[model samples]
Target: MNYSLFAKVFVAVIVIQSFIILIGGQLNIIRVDRLIQQREYEYDRKDMLVVQDAYNHKLKQIRTNVLSLFFDSTQSESILEKIKRYKGTTKAEDLTLQAEIQQFLQSMAYTDESIRSILFVRNSDEQKFAFVRYFDPSLLPNFESMISLKEDEFVKVYPVDASPTKQVLIFILKVNDPNTVGMKQTVGNLVVSIDTGFLQIEGDPLHADSIIELKNSNGTIRMSGNSFAADISQIDLDARKHDSKDYFVTQVDNTVDDMVFTMLISKKQLKQSLFAMKKNQWMTIVAIVFLNVFIAFYISRALSKRVNTVTRNMRKYTPGEFVNPILIQKQDEFTVLEETYNQLILKLSEFIQKEYVMEIKSKEAELQLLHSQVNPHFLSNMLEILRMQAIKENNLNLSDTIYQLSEIFRWNIRNKETVVTLYEELYYIEYYLKLQQFRFPKLQFRIVLPQNLQNQRIVKFSVQPIVENVFKHAMNKGKETDIHIQVIEAYDSIRVSVKDNGKGMVADDLDLLILKMQKPLADTKDTPSVGLMNVHARLQLIFGEPHGLEVQSQIGEGTKVILHIPKNEVGP
Candidate 1:
């Protein structure tokens, strides 16, 4: 082979032709893939829209069913008859009531599977705690909570339900009087439990390369057709990119229930018709590649020596085994090319080293930050609960511990609200005490509240940490911590006292601590007892002027932390 200008021109032509063929093949394949992906995405979105419409219709049917039972003259007679008869906590039904309900239920009129129970809640002071005309209470265990259902829905995945199918969807409708239109007067409530999972979406079931899911606002999948994403960590719920060349995904949000229906489809399944042509195209590219490669292989031997010299020097980059720039005597393009590549390689090497080390360090820093986010005190309490679970055979205690911990975290991490219900606060306190009793083995606690005063609003996490402070400062390792929580109506306001029976502080120390709590807490780096300071600051922030934590302790008895906020200024 002659190494001349004519030979070089022929080699360049062959190389350029091969490059074009290769680029064409790649671009064609990419275009086809893009088309297939777009088609899949559109189909998934279309299907979700159809399903969303179906779900809407299904909800309407449920609402209609509830309305029909109330509006129909025949059903109305029975519905009113129950109110007249089962006034309060009527567990047993009379023959007439039973016969009427059984006949109505057997008519199989509603959208639900069957009638679990027909509860008519009559309006009265004592009736708030009782349901009137409750029938067939076997299937509906603790159906009383349905009284607090804020909105109507097809509740397919209730947390408290442990049914094997776990598919009991309930529809609760507020009953109004007059049995006519435009009536908002609350006479009673209707509780209807549907057995079947709202089988509204029809046609073929999802195939292997597809999935359907109903996800809540938190991206928690409430119900799914198949066993996918059981351990949610495996799937990225918040990923921005919805589609890829291989698969497609689209979401349809149902505003009524604040839930989303997701449909996913595989690109392979979507391009069933175009797949055959893809095989032929690949075969043609293979043939062209072989021919172009054959001609280029023979024509390109003359240039290989120079190219190899450049690539071989480039390979010496690893392990910092590099040399100075080459001193080529030949006055041609290869010499300029090698020298240019050498400078480029040096700059690229420096860039990679800096970025690689920096990225590794940044990732380590991020992981360390995440690890620190897990509070040590919270972890210790959880570990203690686990220890209780391991030692005791009683599942009830374990359940209570888990429930309390869940409620605490629920209020802590998820709820960013400034105000909360005192009832919820008290519930959290009770659970914390129960767990502490298990840990201390002798810790006894009692909560005494004024009659009907648990509904007042206060700050979030206001009471639990104060009671924890009691256990920390007052109780001894061996002795039981006797803590009493009392809520009483003071002069135009409410006073909450958390009294502990352990070693108490002196007057001087008590005064100092109260003084510290009275002042506003600034966002400082080093602060002792964050729990107390944060709670104190939060109370004062919510309720103004001399309304914060008060500490009173004696030498031997114990300490009492008093929290005073207005009955008028309770919020969020």
Candidate 2:
């Protein structure tokens, strides 16, 4: 009853638990942060790839349009006439022709702001004229490459001016004209430049200070955008590295072997919020630790006091004092235990007194039942008197029935033992069937049992009561009853099943009858099927569980009752 030991154990356990929790919490915070960063990176990669794919598709479209222009010129047999209309007349150049040309150039820009400029290089002038989206007609950058173009070509990435920061990608097409018969002549070249900024994609977890860049086959960056600059060669795939004072770098290779996308992230800007989160979590941990210690101390003291109180009450309690329980006011384990202990003592006393009285009454009731068992002999003796009188009249069938009835009583009266040879029981059943046939002339019965198993023993009255019960219900509407009895010797057990073709019971009533057969001897007192219940209980007593009467019946078909008994446990 020394609760100091319990207090010491509680304190030690709580201290160990607190240390483990602290270590686990720190590790958890680190792991959770890494997972968050990983998820952010995954989302960023998807968004960046979306932008890359869409941008590539747009560039392909622009190339297709330029090729269409070339194809159109080849079909125009009067291409020289159209050119002369624009080039030959000064009023045509100032008004109708120039406006039409400018309108076509503007249409090439479409709604995409990334297409900064469009140009038509005559190859005859070696000078290029361009129409920018916002500015007036100006010379396009990287127009020098237009001189050598014979077929369609995608040019290398071009810088805007001296600075290679804001780059543009260009495609050039070689145009042909069909003005001269039997000859195809080269016409002006068509060139389109796309601004790189339009390829940038921004999404959640992708920082503004993060740069996304794509590199082509020559290791030169084809596209770069956002607040930071990134070198494709400096970044490695599946690796994080510091690139410069302003950025951290990572990159991944695309499906194209030579192309890769790289990102430059500002380290401080990306991790500042995470750092703040770690600080708050650390503060929360400290508070939790204090709360845990206070709770552990309070619980330890309260449990120690409850243990002392229980110990004192138990020591002071005597037999008579069980009337008043050891009471604890708080609704906790100790309170429940004390109340249950007192209630248990009270119930135990009551149960013991009731059981004592019931045992004596049960013994007395059993003796009275044994005395009451004499009633059947009076009926048997009357049948004996009838047989004597039938013998006097020389009526053989009447005498034979009386003789069979006498045999049944003799078998019942003989030792009142639970078992008889299988042959003896079958013989009595045959005699009983004769009496039943005399009673019901149309009823027929069949018995199927192996000759070798006839000498085996079974519960004496088990088969008789089942047949009697069947006959009782089997006479429904006076329809002829056909009874089939199968006594088969199985692998580990013996089965005696009685199946009758008669008006069988509905499910609810059949359930009640099966329930009676299943009950233990002590539970069958109130049920109406005493004879069958007695047989079922005896089989269970002799052969153990699952060795008893089984009932099966349907509303119109028939009823089947199988008596299951262990072969080894029954007869020799």
Candidate 3:
């Protein structure tokens, strides 16, 4: 997408951070959900325990009150004797005993609001005495059917419908003759009906959909705190099914009765709570991601700005032009790079200045040397006329001398080429030396050139300058100055050496002359060694090093100057 550094950094940081945050948030949500489930389970368990305890306590209290009514000093003997003496007789005592029992039951019902009715049955005639409160006659048959008890059971509790709308818990106790031992003799039965409403939990449930159920071991519900249509047993109560239709079931077994107390808490409320938590967590994660992206953007922008500054400065630079150094406020890697670039620019500037000036000077020296030469046509015509005049007078030596001078002038003037063959240059050098011999009769010279090297090409005036320097500076006044010019070939280049048995320079003078030749042409222009320096500079500027001049000399030994030239075919 060609995204900039800032965008790349910001996106990378946000993506990485958001991924981590999302993963961590998901894990946190799972952990919190588990913790909330555990808390709900424990809370529901406590509520079930509370309901169980209350029911057990109420049952125990009912049992105690009922037993107290029979076992009381005044009531125990009267009720036991009356129940034992009764045999379905309509005597005044029996009627009176039934009236007393009814009055006692009424009193007990008035004292305990949970009690609905009490029944007394005589086993001798199967006659029933009942004190009914808010009773339905239609339910009398169902109540009578549950009154029968097993011979070995002392007491039994059952949940039965007292009326179409009223439900009660019936506690049946067997009345036995205490005077008879071994197999106790049955006298009567006492059945107390306590309203099932007393078994309900008192307080509101923990959640709106929470239900508390009281059921027997056989799964028949006796009482419930909340009205629920669906059977709790049919619903999936697994905690892991929180995402689906599920409930958290908590059950407790009552010690006073063979009953189970269950609390059903719907997962709908839990799911809602978890969704809200996840929303808040995602909001926090998004906020953190944005903050991190902002920081990354700021850092990337600062770095990009520094890099751009460097690039802008570099773009402004051109060869042979000055460039300003980059100014960086911070001392970091960029600062080091800026400093290195500045140093490189400075070195480049110095190199360009040196090479540029040297090129201009070399061209100016060549033009000046060319302008100083005599007009070729006029010099050649005058030299030929002088040679003809010497021949006309029969002066053979003078005519030959004039002819050699004309040949030297013709070679120098007629050739406009920058390069020439070694043989042509040597022909010019021989004529110049012959003319020099005319001036100094003691000057003697010999030229030795290999036949293969005759066609070696060099700059036109390369050899003449060194030979002129030898003649001007190395010639002795009176002694015979023997000059030997020899050409040698190497693997990659050619060398031309000029040796002379003349007044050779001392070590100090030779060193000074060599130093002057190596200096800039402007510095040596007024010096006598200008010709030598011109030749050295031209060779270097044209061919580059190591294609220049080298000199060897001593106080007594003659000086030898070698011209190093590259091997090339003669120019057309």
Candidate 4:
């Protein structure tokens, strides 16, 4: 994908942050779920304890009521004497005693609604008196089975089938009579049939969806709160296993009856509660994630903007042209990059400037070479023949003028050196002015060279061009055009001033000419000030700046052009 820096940075941050959020969120969910399980398990344990206490209290009350009716009640002796003597009585007396025992059992059953039935069995003659309230008499165990219980076993419980579809628990207790020696004698057994409903919890369950059960020591369920019975084999009953994904089980031991109170808590309910509790946390995490995304986008966009600015400027760059430096408001790594780039651009500009100057010098040298290709010897011989003929015809002035022109041409072409001593240049200038005087009889000139600077080396043709410009542009018709050339020594350099007493230039024209001279020689080649610009460019290129042409002029007053050159000779 052709992703920009901004997109790449933003996506990288988001992916990393999302990964962290995913891992952290999962860990949080695990921790919260565990805490929910622990809290629910503790609550279920406490509720189970409460149920166990209530069961114990109910059992103890039932036991107290049964014991009082068997031994301490007012009818206890009558019931026992009647049960013991019933075997030897007449048929009529037996019926009367059976009726009396039935009435006593009826009174006990009426006292407690949970009491389904009560029975009194006499041990002496194996006689039985039973009263049934809620059970079928055919479902009772034989008298032999009831009496076979050990005397030391005071009370025992059993699950009895009351009908095909109903079951009840029976509590059997032994009745004892005291003898003269204070020893107790077994009289009979009292059996109480209790409705299984009494084993159920009294109030609503702790959890509406949970299952509560009361199981005997053998793991058989005696009473249950919910009709749907949970499979006991699926769980490790001995270990009291609770850590199940489907259900959280809690078992409380009922010491009073050796039973177990078990509560099955659904894990689905715990998960619902956990979700509700973590709703706010999830919202906060989402908010943080969004905020991080925005921050990532902002940062990436800002960096990209800076980079694009730098790149755009780089694209605009061209050799020998000015490129503006990049501007950045913030101070960071980009600032350093901007500074380095600006520095590099500055260095490049300098290098291009030097190359341009060298190129101009090369072109000028090629022009000079082209001009030099002509045979200088033929021209010299022709000019010498003309001068000799003028001398033979007695025209001395013409002969001298022809000789000066020949010397100037030979000096101009003979040497390829770019620098020449001041004395030779001044001598060449004097010869040129003499020839110009031949054409303009009223022209006047002066050459004042200092003795110490006569041998100072400077660029060739630097002085002659300025003097020639005076004749070409500064001459005033019908008046003497006076020219003055002087060499003055200054600090670390020499100034050759060429003054002309001809019609001078106006301020605007002088400024234009000076401006043209200041440009690169190649740029000013076709301008009217080419000769002046040429001299200025050569001086600056050879001796470096502060050593070029400077002009002062005024209309109708005069014009002076100064050539500045270094005092120390330097090769071009």
Best-to-worst order by lDDT is 4, 3, 2, 1
User: Candidates' lDDT values, in order?
Assistant: 0.61, 0.66, 0.73, 0.75
**In terms of TM-score, how similar is model 4 to the real structure?**
0.45
Arrange candidates by TM-score, descending: 4, 2, 3, 1
How much is the lDDT of residue 219 in candidate 2?
31
In model 2, where is the ten-residue run with the lowest total lDDT? 154-163
Q: Which candidate is the best by TM-score?
A: 4
Displacement of residue 284 (Cα, Å) in model 1 is 20
Model 2 local distance difference test score:
0.66
The better-scoring model by TM-score among 3 and 4 is: 4
lDDT of 2 by residue, 1-572 (tens): 56698898998987787678768877887887678666655666576676557555765677666554433444452322343345534674446655655566677687567777777666555434457763322343434643455343333333232134655655455556645564246666666667665565323334556656666643344333354345533545334554444355556665523456666566566577667765776567678879999999999998898788767766775553344555657887678777777677677665665566456545754665477568668878898999999999999899999999898877766746657777777888989998999998988999887887787768776788889987776666668888898898888888998899878889899888777666567453422224777777667766777788888888788889888877643345
lDDT of 1 by residue, 203-298 (tens): 343555555666553234333444442532255534624547555667788877766776665556556646665557646766877989987987
Assess candidate 1 and give its lDDT: 0.61
What would the TM-scores of all predictions be? 0.34, 0.44, 0.42, 0.45
**Model 4, runs deviating above 4 Å:** 1-301, 304-325, 328-333, 522-530, 570-572
lDDT of prediction 4: 0.75
C-alpha RMSD by candidate, in order: 27.9, 24.7, 44.3, 45.1
lDDT of 3 by residue, 1-572 (tens): 69999999999998898888888888989998889777877877887777777667766776666464445575545555665665556889777877776777677778877777777777777677777886532255555555566788776677664544456667777777666896378776777777766645444343556665566732244333333434434544344334334667777877766887767777776798789877787687777768999999998998999888878878888898787777657888788887888788889997898788777665765776577475766888998998899899999988888888888777766776767889988988898898888878888899999999999987778888788877778776778889899999998999999888877889999898888877655253532224777778767766776788898987667889999999986745
Highest lDDT among the candidates is held by which one? 4
